[model samples]
Target: MSSPSTPAGDLAFVVRTIARTAVDNEGAFGDLDAVAGDGDFGYSLARGFEIVLADWDTLDPGTPDEFLKKVALVISKRVGGTSGPLWGTAFLRAAGAVKDRTELDAADAVAMLRAAAEGIKARGKSDLGDKTLLDALIPMTDALEQRLAEGGPGAGPAELAALAASTARTSADATTSMQARRGRQSYTGERSIGSPDPGAVAVAVMAERVAAEWDVRD
Candidate 1:
């Protein structure tokens, strides 16, 4: 499997990976969500991504941003629960970040992630340390940006992705110590402290999958 060399190809690879991850981990994600909130996170995510996969052949692949925007529409419209709006907003903002760009570099990737984080923050009315996915997403983005800034030898795409994935996993784990301040889990207050945020865990899992499979995607 050859790696994608173009922006469109790269976007396709990433979206496919995320969709597959969500679909494959449905039961696990639902179980994690059950520990805190209602066990619908996995179902909502899988349903949304299932639509994406089902409509893969029909979505335009002319540009990365265009593809992402279409995906956002699908997620927002087809997915149920709060997951739809939050994740859809993330993708929409990401698409906006790179609008009209013919190509993308590390900086563009960081910018897209930042935009997505901001979108999530705005849509979910949440922030870092809220025991939401932001806890993992923000740190992962920061790690990627920092790694890119450092720019040492061998700090390529795969290495940066691995670093982000590691950061996401660690940050997601840290959420176990934080009481949920947002979302349905917040209703349980201190009870949410013992379990990590399902959204954060999902982000970590997806990042890990992307990193592990980066070299093999085409």
Candidate 2:
């Protein structure tokens, strides 16, 4: 395969990719949210992406950081509930990680993902095993980091992203057995065990998108 293009084009592709993912999974996300939240997770994300699509032409194409900052602003302002701020913060953190970079390599992608995961952790004040999005994100980032650390000469962004995506799916599935420790779902005590966290599902979706869309070449 070929290497991915510069950050500016990558941003545009990622936006479109996420928008499609949101629309495709909105119903399932709502169903998952209905298990613990107000069932608005899907609608909120779809709406936020809709706004992004509408404003696609205006997004800055100069750098990945600027584009992600714009994305964060839109998600925070247009989406409602905790998801808005949480996701926005993640994107913002990613933007900061890549600030001033015109292109992103495999290691940069790993760093950005790691930054986003840490952002979610700090912003949500949540931890692993919290039965939140962190469950999926943390594990995925860990897997990516491990790949980057171990695969020395051959590891590429697409391969690492695929590994992370697989880990995300597994982590998200594991959430079904974990009782919620934070968020409104915590009120359910043991009753929330049957359903996975919607946010976790969304994180898995993001991982999948990155794995599919990112170009990986040495």
Q: Which one wins on lDDT?
A: 1
* lDDT (C-alpha, whole model) for all candidates: 0.91, 0.81
> How does each model score on TM-score?
0.96, 0.90
As for model 2, its CA RMSD to the true structure in angstroms is: 3.1
- Candidate 2 residue runs with Cα over 4 Å from true position: 1-4, 152-154, 213-218
Task: Estimate the TM-score for candidate 2.
Answer: 0.90
Give candidate 1 regions above 4 Å deviation: 1-3
- Candidate 1 on 1-218: residue-level lDDT in tens? 11387666776787889999999999999999999799999999999999999998887655768888999999999888999999999999999999988787888889999999999999999999999999999999998888888888868888888898999999999999999999999999899988899999999999999999998886
Q: Residue 136 of candidate 1: its Cα lDDT?
A: 97
Worst 10 residues of 2 by lDDT: 1-10
